[model samples]
Target chain A: MIDSIQIRDFRGIRWGEVDGFKQLNLLVGPNNSGKSTLLEAIYLGCTAGQPAHWEGDSFEPAQVSLSGRDFLGDLPLLRVLKRHRYHLRKAGQGPYRDGCLNISISSPAAPLRRFQLHVPDLPILPDSLRDMDSKISRIEIDEGAQVALFACASGRDAGRAERALAGRILQLLSPTQGAGSTRQKTVQSGHKTPSGPNKQRRTAQRGARPSSGTAGPGQQTAIPRRPPAAQHCIYLWYPDLTYHSAGVAAWSLTGKLASPEHVLFFDVSNTHYHFYKTFLRDTMTRVPGWTYKIADCLREVLGIARSFDFHVQFLPAKDNDSLIQGWIAPRDQPALPIDAYGDGTRTALKILASLLSLVEQATADSPAVLLWEEPELFQNPRMLNRLLREIARLIEGKPLQLFMTTHSLEVVACVAMLVREGLLPADSLRAFRFSLEEGTLRSSWFHADNLLSWLERGMDPRIWDTLGVPLQFTLKEQEEGAE
Target chain B: MSAAMGGSIDAFYEGMTEKKILHMLMQRGLLAKVNLCDGKETGKTEVNRRLRDVVGPNVGTKQVRCLVLRDLDERETMERIKQGLQTALQALYRERGHPKAVVRFVRHRAHGNVYLHTCTELDVRVALHIATYRHLPDFCKSTIDDYVLRVALHHETAAALIKRQGWSISSKRIIHKVTSEIPALLKQNGIPMMGEAKDFIHFYAALLRVHTSPAVFAEKILHHAPESELREVFAPLRAAAEFLQDASSPSMPGDRLPA
Candidate 1:
């Protein structure tokens, strides 16, 4: 388990630390109190080495330059540079050109492992492409020192500019082997092969231009461009591993990020109906045992009897598209389309289906982490209570860590009740109340015993004032005021 | 005056018996002002343990004095209650580290009536008193209830209620039940009668409005009753109030009452 997390200069969070984490951690706060941001922070810290986990949209630059007519083509490179500059400025107010994200994790038997992702300064645009509407001249691509520079010239040497641009982009996407280990192959103008070692070597040897003499105006020479000034590096420090690499580091320390088979995140607000149907279909086809278990869980928590069924209609062979419809059958009633029920039912089904799928894949050696945001939405108190209880039971013996954020006091109260009844151990549960102070998020933890005591005293856990010390009054004033 | 002397007299009670008694004393002008501790027996005991810590030994040459009142509550014997009181007093004295302080029984006569007072000397002065309600000469068993019933039920409306609700029931019991149920009945069926009947119901209507008990209603009545009205209602309680006033008054140390 991750014992604690300290977040700084991430999103709206300036500096905040939540320590003493347990198997189950429930985050409760008012809306817009940075609960979702904190979840995103944890996900980012855990899976930072994976390029897929780093959402490109969240790192968009504050300002976008719209001068280039081919600005859309330059967006990918521009976005990367702009994000680096934006974070470098936001990390601190200085001339610093690099921003670092420092993440540290530890297990029970191993020492702490710290990973640092240092975003280097934005690459400078070549002189040719600096002017507006200037056609590309000579474009050079280099793989030395893990840096690729693009140098282009404009005016009369504008022939095959677009093709040269595409070639350079293709080379950038493919993996570049070490500097002097040359097993180079070449790519002629209009042929691009998908991934393979041969394709990678061929793409690298081709660089950005064809070797044919009459291919284009500036395609004759293929001298390699020098590496850029600033280089992005990821540093990893652990007991057995201490290395820094200039490219995205392969997360060899954990298999989950490398494969990403066990981790799941459900944002109910953005999930589409088709996505949930697809998930249900996949789960039913892959793990037939979990279909009944998930159905039982839904019935127990939501107080609704429902089963998943897919209606398939096969047409003529010439018409290759077949229609498959998924419906939820209520007991002793006609089947209704999954969307016919309320969003609450749909959300519960989506969340439970995904969780059951994770449980199916979980092993004793490798546990899964499920991050759920706003499970309390569209759910009443009774439903929320039952849902939380069922969730506690679902992950009981499995190696699963559950992290959820809720604005419902009912959910918190139910968790407290479970803790009091010893269904969930006091040490296994951690509850934190988040509040915004001075534009930064701050959190206060409620010990399980203290929370149980408060509930036993018939006090509302959400109201902190009720737990304060009783008021003391002077005798003379009380007597004088007495009727 | 006693106000110029910094410390003031304070009273602690197990319940409302001493609180009602103190109100009567203040109304009869026997005591200028008495500070009442605002808690029950357990809370009052905690206050007593912490009294020395709060007020210190003396406040500018005037020592803080306290009066603790308790009911006999039908113990096997009055001696048992007195022994319990003595043990509690000793614990308090020891806790305050004033073991050698003097304790004496002082008697005061006012309006041809006698009342007993127990005085103790801690660094700050203290006193303890007992009210054997069933044993008091004029104010007999349930004195406060009897006083409230007499004042509220002597009107013609109450007499009619007594006659209608069956005179076999005690007038006090009928008044208690009527006062307890009148507000709810009025809310359900509206006011049934007019004039003095309405006023009689309105007088105890606070039972529902504030969710207070019959005991609390009686205390509120005694707290707000005028001196002449209280004197007419219970002369023995008035005499006891005079006795307490004379005992606590600095000016009445010797021969302060009329013969």
Candidate 2:
């Protein structure tokens, strides 16, 4: 579990640091305050060297960003995300330029298990997309040297960026061969000795200069950057996609980011909502046993009295493919199509199922992470309360850490109440408030103690910054005004 | 927000009464147009925490002028104001994350006031204005009711509110208590002056005996309190408001307050 997270110049956040994550980390703030962006940064940080997005079919709007064939590398993503960024010219000053973005996530329990991603605000990705390779990500626990992220515009660029990353990985792990990065094809390669002094000197030298075009937190110390023959670097990440084990073979990642939590960012942004069906279809095919568990979770959280069996049915397609259909078949009752249920149900199912799967696959060594955004979406207060309790229950004693974001202060209160009731661990809920300005996105993290205190004293911890001020919401025509 | 973004001032007050009162002053152009965020009565620590919370959104943008109106639940005097709240202010920014931060109460030749100002490490200019709400500035430390009574009882609107129904203060007993009983009560307490923070406590106690709802009574007085009276009695709030409006350094109240 990533107990702490720090991001500087990632999306709308110029500089933000929030720690004290429990099993459930709550990101609470107003709109445009960079709560969602914080989640995205964690997701990207943990999954460094992995493709940040997969656009799938251009025509298919429902196609999720992290899946399918059309993967987008750093340059392409920069193209998509460049406009949302600004240049923090000074400390808490200046318009957000396309400056470098860095994200560092660490587990306090496992201090060495850290993942840092730094994408240098390269001048190259802004205009021309066809030529650049996004070998920019450096994940040195901190370089990735955390994300030396290079940019590539399309799938065509992905292939090139992938090889460049693999070659850089080869150079970092094996200095003898890394010295040959200018000539050697680092793909399909085996392990070599880790040269501590050589790597340390190079890393420190690179780390010496902070956000310059030439220097950074040196992670992969020896990769000759932007080589002419970028294509001949290596082809390694493709085979490593399924390589989700604790043992990281080769990549910008050296020891792996946190024994490597199977980091999954469950984003519910309007465009990315289509993945629930895809998730259900895959789960039914691979782990049909999870159906009953998911059903039980859904039933208990939704306060449904009756038992049900969550299932996905297959039908013959016009092109001889099996068209998958999902259903919620209640025990001793007629089967109902999953489509008949509301988005809240599906969203819960997605979360519950993912939790179950991750928990089942997780071990003491490698815990799983679920980066859930907007858990309150379409959820009534009662349902939300139940769902939160259910989540706490599901992850109890299990190796699963949930980092979820919600615009609802109700969620913070609910979690506090849960901790109060002993349904959730008292120390395991960290509520962070993100307040955004021009060159800064400030994060204030609250422990259970603060939450309980705020609630007890009639303070709304969610808007702590505006608590003593007369904002529109706090400014009310109440009986207290007479005082 | 840089130069492109407009500036903003937000005041963090202890209770809804202070909020409505400040907002009332803002509406009357007696104070700056401040975003008044009401605080829970968790005391001094909560005030400092809330100030810390507002620092971030302004750290990298156009600096947001902050005015903290925490009712430390005590009466203020010029000696205490002059001694400076640097220790308290220093405690606020001394947390681990605030790097090389320094807090200084604005050095001033101004009178004994309830307000203090300091810049945090992030350079968030925050001014802390003490909300002195007491039954008697010398006697009992109390709620925002004291602030209401202190400012409003001096205004002619207090008599109007006494006569108004459902707005509290109904009978001749209450009117006598406000106009006659309160003065006699203060005299009974061996008090020589009327303007101390303690004096409001006596008036509030009299109104309390009449079953006057503090919130309702405060609202009526704030709404109907004359411009001149507010400018005079609420000069501290107005000072902080004006400080918020200006781009220059923060200034303390030049006017004196009874210890």
Candidate 3:
């Protein structure tokens, strides 16, 4: 688990720092309090090494380039060689000097890596000045050490360095997090490159003598490779009026729709009413004419009640395009010819399908984390409450870790109701208050009760009138006295 | 003179007869003295005895020591009876929390002189008198200027005040002379006559009352000014009154002006 993160001179933060997290962490603060910024920072740092298929496509080595001048500014030899002027002035030991980024990380379950990237400031040169031979700079993890990878026009040391660097980075990526405690071996065993093309000439150039221990044969070396674990992120927001009263269902099912590897996807436009129907159907036996079982596993997971095995047909995306194309479930569902249903059926089907999918996942050992934003859209208050309760019921039976974000009092109230009914762990439930302080994003975490109180005092008072809910407390003392 | 019985109107007129009874009662050295008539008609003797019993020491009375009845003509008596009852009740109040009561009454003419001829002790009389005066403070800070200003502002009628103060000069002449010298009065006090004339009169009258009797003060200063001039001179006072009215009146901001 990543413990703490400190950032400086990055976007939206000067001296930003935040810490304290558990298995299921939450970020909440006022708008522009940098909650999202913090999440992005973690995403960037972990982007370093994710390539293997077992780890999934999420952790591929995306390209991010740094210019050659940064190295000239960071290294001591380049400083004197280039006679960079800006470095001298900003050499002071303050946080935001000319060039310094010392990042420290600690993870007991994973390897601890420190990345200190710096840039040196160069003197201003005339506009016309240009160097034809100057090369674009690159940084690479080489033989367990950070080495400057340069691409010269001449391509002199390119071939050897490329092979060595690629091998080293690959090794760095392949280490298992926890192997039987025999001290797994490092990927690089002091690999050195020949300075000159002639092997004897390179040996003569470096007169070194240090006896090094050799690795026993058939010993498993620990490569720095772990499946880029599903990056659990919950992006919650109070949707616009268009999405108000919209029931949201999203999960990544890792398999084909028909095969055992298949996972279901259901998107509902208005989830409020449908959630109740699905919830009742799941908990209670339906009457003979009202319900039928779909032997097709995918259809069942999708919560499509089928009258007969042959009658089971995949519905077209016409009715479910927006509903199915939600956050988590990748949009690959084959479209069938079906008219867009009215809002009531569309919304109900969307929520029912999502709940059905959740019921399927809950049957499994590991359930996908649900990310929902503003599920209280377009529905009456009663519908909103029912949707929340159904969501809670689905969550209660399922092993899935649920993460939802909302600004609606009814939505929060529903979750609180779940908390009140012992459907979810009170402590497990977290509400984050996101706000801006000192031009940086800051957030405070709260449990269900705290979230409820904050909603009542901070949000409900301001928006209650708009919601048509009777003002629980008067807005002004004078009004209260008059009442 | 015939031996007149006490409590009868006849005995009151026959002063020597009542005085003889009083002297005899004093000589006899009774705890309480009473002159009585036989209970043949209206019980004049019984009334006297009852009065003695009410006033007598060790007779259910906790504090009262003496009582004085200043009767007057019927109209005056009725007015004074209310005034006297109110005044006595006020005197009995324990404003300081300590359980002590002293009842006294003052006739209308006794300006600045409160009669505390009660059955209470001398020290009690002095303390109660001081406390009564202390309760009439115009401000937290005690000053002659403040006292004068307070008196001028609160006292309603100049003629009444003059008559009540028992001023020697005719109220009209005093008022006329003070009115004529209004400019000099303002100049003497180093106060500008920027406000209404009534304001000036009140302010000046208050100053005058501090050093002189209220009657002299009012007659000499207040009555000379006409109502219009008084209103003009008391411009600041008018402003203060306007402010008080605005603060008290109930009207919302959006109310339309009357056509």
Candidate 4:
């Protein structure tokens, strides 16, 4: 169990300390209480070894950078970028407060090892806002002799950049040697050598086509990235703008069949809802150890599963713009792709698949760490409950640890139930109530007993409304006057 | 008779040893409560036939005296005592003139039973005894019983203290001069005897008195003497008493009167 966490000058928090985390930790805090900031900090710390500044030049839509003005112009992208900026600043503070994330992890008999994940700020340029033509800057992991893994990216999509880096770090801790990767060869034969006539005719026709040295790499020819021996850490997000049809198609085709070692990342601004569904479906099917039971629970409760392969597309964005999309399954299934299922079912499926993939990837030899932002997005109480219940079950009897940021009480309640049922050891479950107290993010752990008691008495619903505010207020009013 | 009949020849020869001959004679003397004496001056040859049986070889006479006193002066003042042999010898002779003063043992039974002096002095100025009561009335059985009790308590207390402290003092070594030994060591020189409970009250009050009036008792006893002595010497007793009282008190305020 990690004994405690002390953060300094990271996001909304100037300095915050929390002690007593068992194997499982649930952080509860107000929206701005730096709950997500804390998770991002851990991700950064774990993957802080590599330099972010790398070589890549691809002008993609997701890479199109915008200024504070242009970024603000698009409310959805602006909000997304704002959160990224906060993380960047936090990860960059060096002397007085290096924008860095520090993590402390421990085993039963081992001492705590403090690690720092450092990343330099890589701002997207206005010209590259529409086409993501940026690259990673610098990543420094384990700066102080502490164990850390770092990755750097210069992509227009900071979310993908971070996820790619996180995946690299997780690969170091638990290397998955053999499940999803395989090698194969092809053999061709001809009767009587087909020799004279057919062989020469084919050669002569090929030679007549003109020698233009312009052949691109094909899907079948492209060499796959060998699975990293170590376990993986996944970073994911959804499309912020633009149509996601093409991205969604690519996701189900080759992406689904790739090694599970490839951490799932959703740059929503450049991804369609179908991509999420396909990813979920593929993760559920392809991963060696994910299950539909968790999915069923989610569906029964939430009435939705985002990636159940229901073939439904074109979810309305915050700006009221519809991202055109579609879902296609193999001919064997025949019916509309599973993505066609209702939005709720598809959403639930996506959440369950993501959780299960992480769980499956997390074997004893290579356990994984999963991070998710706003897990409660488009989720109702039942769905949220099912999702949390599934997550607890995933880590229930495994070596995997999960970190997530949520603004839903239902999610918190589910976690509390898991803790109460003894599914999670006292030290395993942790929650932080977060809020901006006096212009700064203040955080404290929510004791399970105290939280249940508070819930039993029926807390104000507003705590769920302003994710950061209500939690902060409740925690402050309750914890500040401690006897 | 068995030896005369020759059934056991060893029995006939047993009287040849000095110890056996002396034992046989002592058994015949019936020395149950009486002091025994040996005839050391008798002719060795004339008594040869039964010399070993009539008187053992070693013979000596030691004088012993039993003197009794009472605290009759009633002064509460310190009484000066001194040993004078002439006065003690005359008193003993007057009390038991018919007996020779061979082995003299001086046993005093005043405030309590105790062995008085090892030997009485020859000076006639000695009173040979002191008094709190008028006279040594008759040597009644009740007085003896009281003496035994006094001796037992003193011996027991000393033995207990030695056992408790794991000290080396033997109970036999502590000769009780009077029943007033413990109290006298705790209070001033001429202080009167106060009962156990009254003694504690007086001791506590003396502590209060020392702080209040330091000059009143300075002539005979220092103002701080009683309090200091009581506090230091009786500390264990005082602590035990306090503990007992506290344990007996009811904790609830309203339940003080058993309502």
lDDT of 3 by residue, A174-275 (tens): 222121112323221211221121211111100011111122122134222221211111111101100121111001111101111111212132332112
TM-score of 3: 0.29
Indicate which candidate wins on DockQ.
2
Off by over 4 Å in 3: A1-50, A53-313, A318-348, A362-365, A437-439, A452-483, B1-259
Q: Taking the tens digit of each residue's C-alpha lDDT, what string does model 1 give over A1-483?
A: 444554433344443556555677788766656676566544433322222001011121111111111111121222222222321111111221223232232312111122222223222343322222223222321111111112121112213442232222222212231112122223222111112212111111111222122212323233122111111111111211111112111110111210134555555532332332334455556766765676687787777544433221112222112212235665566766555667776777667756777777666555566767777887877887888788877777777666788766677778888887878878788776675543345565556754554344343434322225553221222232222
Rank order (by lDDT, best first) = 2, 1, 4, 3
- The better-scoring model by lDDT among 1 and 4 is 1
Model 2, A1-483: lDDT tens digits are: 554543433445444555556777888877878787666555444433222311111111010011111011122223223223321111111122222222211111111111111122222321112212233222201211212232111112223333334333334333232211223332221112222221211011111111112111212344433222121111111111102211122222111122222556564432122333334455556565786777777888878646444453323322223233346776577776555778777677666766776666666566566778788888888898888888888788877677778877678778889888998887777777767765355666666766765555455656634445543322333553333
By the TM-score metric, which is better: model 1 or model 2?
A: 2
True contacts kept of each: 0.00, 0.22, 0.00, 0.00
Q: Over 4 Å off in model 2, which ranges?
A: A3-23, A26-261, A267-290, A306-326, A336-340, A373-385, A405-477, A480-483, B1-7, B13-17, B39-46, B49-64, B70-96, B131-211, B249-259
Error of 4 at A243 (Å): 34
Position A282, candidate 4: lDDT? 49
Query: TM per model?
Result: 0.40, 0.58, 0.29, 0.33
Candidate 3 B-chain TM-score: 0.20
lDDT of each: 0.42, 0.48, 0.29, 0.32
List ranges where model 1 is wrong by over 4 Å: A49-260, A270-288, A305-326, A330-335, A455-460, A463-483, B1-259
Q: What is the lDDT of residue B27 in candidate 1?
A: 65
lDDT of 2 by residue, B1-259 (tens): 3453344686765556666677677777777677655454534455555654444333433355787665544454534533444554455445424545665566323423444564532445556565444545454444455656655655365555555545554445554566567677778999765644434544654564445454454656677777777776666666665655666543443343221
DockQ scores for all the models shown?
Answer: 0.02, 0.14, 0.01, 0.01
- Which residue window of length 10 is worst by lDDT in model 2 chain A? A61-70
Worst 10 residues of 2 chain B by lDDT: B250-259
Query: By DockQ thresholds, what CAPRI class is model 2?
Result: incorrect
Quote model 1's TM-score for chain B.
0.51
For all the candidates, what are their Cα RMSDs to the real structure? 23.1, 14.2, 32.6, 37.4
